[model samples]
Every structure is written in structure tokens, then in C-alpha cells.
Target: MPPFGQGVSVTLEHLFDPGAVAVVGASDTEGKVGYEAMANAVAFDGPVSPVNPSGSGTLFGEQFVGSVTDVDDDVDLALCCVPGPAVPEVVAACGEAGIGAAVVYASGFAEAGPDGEALQAETAAAAREGDVTLLGPNTSGFVVPARDLLCSFASGVADIPAGNTAVVAQSGGLAHVLAFLSRRQDRGVSAMVGLGNRATVGFAETVRYFDADDRTDAIVLHVEGTDDGRALLSACRESETPVVAYKVGQSDVGDFAASHTGALTGDHALYAAGFAQYGVPTVEASDRLLDAAAALGDSPDPDGPNVGVVTAQAGPGIIIADRIQRAGGRLPELADETRERVDDALRGVTYTGNPVDTGRPMPEFGDVVTAVAEDDNVDIVLVYELFEAALGFPVDALSGLAGRVDKPVLFATEGIEEDMAADRRALSAAGVPLFATPERAAEAAGVLARYAGLSDRREAPADD
Candidate 1:
């Protein structure tokens, strides 16, 4: 395998927030990839110029240049929308033009056969010789929701709104999937990047960069595989910000993963173990990864593994308890005083223990939750309640309690989607994360407790 970025300066800032962007092979044709790249690049919060070796024409209000070097203004990033065989020259020309970075949207590199591998190595050499950072050879590109910057050619990705979470994935497709899922959850992302083919930049570099980024509160890493595990471990260990990882390639798909990203999917068990040792939580599914990162990012670090479950209905509450406990979370018995308070609030009509079941929505549902949230043994509170038009969400009560308490409180509910919109917004404004299902809420609560346990383990002194 050929080395990458020997002399190149890899500045993620240039890749993420470039001062100017050039879309090489830009086209005015609506259906062309070049056209889509141009359309998205124009939305960037900087000067966006189109570069085409063909005849120049006006598209998206920007005049096309014959070459990147021909452009009068300096370009910090170039979207190489050209073919694989054409990438090396593009990188060299971009370097000669003083462009700091370039994103290769072309495929058929290392992921392809031997000839493609040679092409990838050549592309890497050109990038290194040019001292330019490269993002991908098979990437769908990235999006910065806050800046309204769309560095990708993929559709629907441009609509992702800005939020506190940053998603970095090995697959551009998966990255966009998580972004859209976040949007569906009414929670968006700060930035979403795909490390496709990883011609130069990989997870370690991206993680370290996002760790120092103030815009990112939490990072969700989607790893298919990697050869440089130690670098990733160090980066995750150094991050004070919360990180949740989703590792794929669990089945007998190592060869497929290798063909996909040019990196062999190493032992999945080793990856999980190393991630745990480095204090980073790992999840298997994409939704779980997003939920964990969202909960950890928005909610306070939980103090312990004890979760207080307060449900308006018994069935969903039972489901939440099962999921949380299975994920290593504890539903501790409520303090006697706490149970008494819950009983008084619920009129002894339902179970008032750790997994407190309110039976149904009632006037004092908020008080029942408050008692559990304030319990001495409850370090995290998980509440599951179906929306009732008459009683509605306990927004005011939970918001007030969350404001005063230092623990994590998660709310899960199912209701008429349109009707719950306003309350959902209100809860979001209060810094409370609301899930659409009992299992999701419980999974998020379990993530909180797992993170807290990791912290405790890290802080504990070594055995004598």
C-alpha cells in the first residue's frame, strides 16, 4: 500500500469551511454530477467559482474558469468532479494554484482492482507532492448545516439543519442516512462528513479536528474498518467531548468492507474492546449511535448507572426497564420518602417503585416524575408517557426539574405527530431530549448510564 500526505498540510478547516471553492469539471447541465456539485458549492458562505477545462459559461451566477490556476482569486478547496484517471493532474494543478485542499468525488481508486489501487497511490503521491489535503476518492462529500455549506453532490443532504452533533462515517451513504435520521428526530447535525476511500484524511484526523471544534458538542463515528486503530484510540481518549461509535462488519463481510473502503475490517471484538478501554461508548446500530450521541451531547453527564423510570402506562414502562437493565443500567428502588411522595401524587393507583408506572396520564403525572427525578438513588431518569390531548406532556414540570437537577432526564412518547410538535419544540428549548418510542428512550438512558460508568471506571484508582 502506498503512503499518503507525506508533505501535505491537512487542515480540516479548509475542507470544512473553505474561503473559496472551485468545482472542477463544473457543468451547466441540470442532470450532471458537475451541475449538482456547482449548485451545492454556490450555497457555501464564500466565493464559489466553477472550473471547467471546456468552454466557459455562466451557471449559478458564477463564471467558469478554464483551470483552477486560471482563476484570479485564491481557492482554498477544490471539488474534483472529474474521473479517476484525471484526479492526479487535478490535484497537481490545484497544488500549483495554492489550493489548500481538494475533495475527490470520483470512485475506482483503491476500492477497485489492482489498476485502481495504482491509480489511488498515484493520486495520493500527487496530493502529497502538491502539499494539499484530500478528503476522498469515492466520497459523497460533506455538509456544514450552520454555514449552509453543502460540499456534497448528493440530494436531500442539503436540507439537513444545524444542531450540536457531528457525524463522521466511513460510508458517505451512511453519513447521510444518519443526518436524515437526525432530521427525522427533529434533531439535526452540526456537520456531517464521509471519509470515503480515505485517500488522505481518516477517522483519527477528523475526530481530532472535531474535538477542538466549538460547534460540535458530540461526535458520532461510524467505522467500517481501519488499519490505524491506535491513532483513533488516542484521538477518542483526548476528546473531552462525548463520542459514540457504531462499528459495522460484525458478520462475515470483512471482504466486502475491504472492497468498499480499501481497509480490511479487522476483528470487531478488538475494536469494541479498544473503544471501551479508551472511554468511548460503542453501539451496533445507526439509530442507537445517534441516540446515544444525542443524549450524551444534550443532557448532563449522568452521575451513576441508576435510572429512575416513570411511565404513564405500565406496558411501555416495562419495556423501558427491560431494555435499560439489559444494557447494564440499574433501576434502583426509590428511596422510601421518594416512594411516599410518588404515592401521594398518584393516589396509590399505580406502582410507585423505581420503574414507577402511573398506569395512565393523570393530573399529578408531573409530580410523580418529579419525585422520581429527585430520588436519592436515581442518577438518571427515564420517563415514558403516551401523549394525551387532555393531560399533554409534563413540559413545565420536567423542564423546571431539569433546570434544578444535575442528572439526565429523558422523555419518550408516542402520539399524534402534528399535535405533539409544539410540546416537542418546548421540551427541546428546555434542553430535554424527547424520543418517539419507549425503546429509543430506554436505549438513550442506558447510554447515559454506560457513559457514567465509564467515567467512574476511568477515575477510579488502579488496583494495588
Candidate 2:
């Protein structure tokens, strides 16, 4: 049997930085996929040629061609806005036109049934014959904010500015979900791609490509499942950049997941075990996936699973400590010297154990945090303090401490957005990720610890 889609070239640069694009099924009607695809494509930094046999005149400030072969300019990518039945022909036409890449926006193949699967096979065959790299037969396309490229039809994606995070999701909707969540959290992504149906491109190809991408610092994978899980695992294991994953279909959603993207979504427990063995940090919730990515991308990896937490309020600290311990992290007891220093700083005002709760945002809170972070036992530090305009964030102290320490220092706070905006930026600029919720911050810390443990296991010598 032919090796999976004949291993067609999925050169990400060509797909992402195409000099010019062709919309194979461009439409003039509002709300149509062709129109929206064209609408997004015109924002590209290069020329966009819309192709439709019946298309005429200009739409979205681009001239419409009768076919892909008719376009005079060299096109690197084609967005097949046509229906499922017409996609193979369009992909074949793109290959004939020397276009190296295409994104098929149509559904119906594979997930629909055996007939659809046959059609999907045909689509793949056409792509292989044409030497064309296909993105999807059922996908939402992709976005490269740094290049001012938005190939997806999804709105609000245009505003996701250039950043270091890269999202590789199996489902297009989930891709958008992570992108929008990142935007909402004021986090930007270098690129976000949806691997739909996987007629050609899948997790391994995309992950390996992004792993080498200089623009990407962290890669987040939203996995339902794949037949090529081993390849995906290999890519993750080989990636120099940090990779975080969120695998769904943990329950009886296997059929639903398969229908969504023709994924296997086999036993969730097996996937979890495989991911753990491969050293990829897996998150449970969708939002937490983005959270973990941002955290891992921005913060330094911990030396061990030992975390030192300093909270101004004991209640929230308890919540954070509980969640941290539950997530495979340890709040180890502070060293004797560390406890003494914290005691000296807090003046015995509150708990001085591993959590080191101060009861309130006291003046010496920063000093206590420093004491805990400086402790040799603590590999990571998590700080929580409510917004007290009077006390303000320990920006100067925390920034200085973070700069000095080799480990990660994460902050968790809740306050009026307007009031904390400047401090948030300051902390972020200092390489500290400030989460809005205690759970989110704690979870971020837990991921760092989890990854550290995974790394330890990976590097540990196997028993003879």
C-alpha cells in the first residue's frame, strides 16, 4: 500500500508565505465560503488571483480569473472554495498550473461515509499526482499574523497579532477557539493551523515544520486522534521548542471525533500514556491548553517538580496549592534558611510553610517571595496577590528577582482590568506570566513541573 498520502511536500513556508494566492472558487455573494475566503486572502502581502469559471469583474479588490491555469502570475497557493465534488479537479488544475499548495474548504469526504472516503482518496491522489501540498478537504485554513496573512474565513482572526505561540489543532473550530482565547488573554500567535481530514498534511508534518520555525517559540497541539500517532509522537520528541497538547475524545466521543475529522481518537488512556512517555505536556481543558503553552513558551523550565508558592491571601493560596499538588507538582517545605528569611520578612504574621501565606498584601511580601525563590529546594515560584492599588504589584522586586533567578517566577492576580493593565504589561515584559485566576496560574506552574519531570524521565538511563 502507498505510504500515507504518498508523503506529499507540505513545505510550510510555501503554504504560509506564498508570493501569490489563487482562490479556485471565488464568489461575489455575501456570506458564501468563496467570498469569505477571498475576503481573507486579499489581506495577504502578495497578489491574490480569484479563480471561478463564472467569476467576472473584481471582488475584494482582486481580479477574478476563469480558472487556475488562466492566471498569468505565478501562484504558490490555491484556496479551493468549491464544493466537495469539485475539489479534486481544482487541485488537479492547481498542480497543472504549477501551484505547489492548496487549501480545500469543502467537507463531506471521509467523515461522511465510505463514498466520501473514496472521494477523499481521489483528492489525495490528485494532490500527489500534481505534486501539490493540500491543507484540508475539511478545514478552516490558517493564519500567519506576522506575515499579515489570513487564509482562513474565520473573522476576528485577523486581529491576532504576531507572537511566539503557534497552534496546530486537528479541528478547525478548535484552532479558532485557541486563537480567540489567546487574543482574549492578550496573547498573540505567530501562526495557527487547522489540519482537517488530513488528506495530506497532518500532525507530524505540521509539528516538525513548526519545530524548525524561528518565529514559533511554543507549539500547542489540539488532538482528537490520528492514525499516525507514532509519527506525531516522534515529532514532539524531536522538537527543540516546547510542545503542549490537549487531547479530546476522552469519553465515548470516538465516533463523533472520527466524523469531525476522520480521526481514530482511540482509547484516551492510551493516548495519555503515550503522550506522557513521549514527554509532551498534556492539558485537560481547552483554555488550559493555551494557558500551558503560553506559560511554557514564556517561562524557564524548572529544575525539578518542587514549587515554592507565596500568596498574600491564604484562601487563594490553599486553592493554588491544592491544584498544584493535584497536577503532579510538589509544594515542598522551605529550607531552614529560607523559612528564617521569610519569617524575618513577614514578622510571623502568617503561615510560613511551603505556601508562605501572608494573610494580606503586606509591605514585606516581595521580600518573602524572594526568600522562597532563593531557596535551593524550590525549582519554581508561584506568587498570588490581590489587586491593592495602595500596595500595587511588587513589580520592581519581582522583576529584579526574576531577572536574577534562573528558574521561573509566575504571578497570579485578580483586579480591575483598567487598574492592573500597566503592571500586567510590566510583569509580562519582565518575562513573568501573570494569570487572571489562581487556578490558571497554578496550572501553568504545574505544567512547568510536569514537563520538568518528563524531561528527567527521558534523560534518565534505562535499567540494564
Predictions in order: lDDT: 0.86, 0.86
TM-score of 2: 0.95
Question: Against the hidden reference, what TM-scores do the models get?
Answer: 0.95, 0.95
Of candidate 1, the 10-residue stretch with the lowest lDDT total is 1-10
What is candidate 1's lDDT per residue for 70-103, written digit by digit as tens?
9887789999999889999999999999998999
lDDT score, residue 258, model 1?
Answer: 78
Q: Point out where model 2 deviates above 4 Å.
A: 1-5, 400-403, 457-464
lDDT of 2 by residue, 375-413 (tens): 999998999999898878988788857557778888989
Q: Give the Å error, residue 291, model 1.
A: 1.1
Q: How far in Å is the alpha carbon of 60 misplaced in model 1?
A: 1.0
